[model samples]
Target: MYFCLFPTWHSKVFRNDVIFIYDKYFFNLWFDLYLKYFFLTSELIILISSLWV
Candidate 1:
């Protein structure tokens, strides 16, 4: 499972508390980037389609 991999993935192993903190921060940053990229692409698609029509 994805949860099981975290402990061994790092060069220096960390405690679960540390791993959990890392997971939370990584997820939040990735989620924010994904949302911004999704919105920008969607708007561009709409703009292009309208201009083409």
Candidate 2:
């Protein structure tokens, strides 16, 4: 899902010259959100497995 979204996101960033000014900031924000979502999902899975066990 991330891989699929990345191409379009990357293209949008590259296509808009003005956004290039804040590209690093935007990329960092995107990465942080992704990581948060990934970790939350992982923790939920672990918790569920523990409950099952």
Question: Best by lDDT, which number?
Answer: 2
Task: Find the candidate with the highest TM-score and give its number.
Answer: 1
Candidate 1, which segments miss by more than 4 Å at Cα?
Answer: 1-15
TM-score of each: 0.70, 0.62
lDDT of 1: 0.70
What lDDT tens digits, residue by residue, belong to model 2 across residues 1-53? 66344534654657876655456566677788999999999999999999999
Whole-model lDDT values for every prediction: 0.70, 0.71
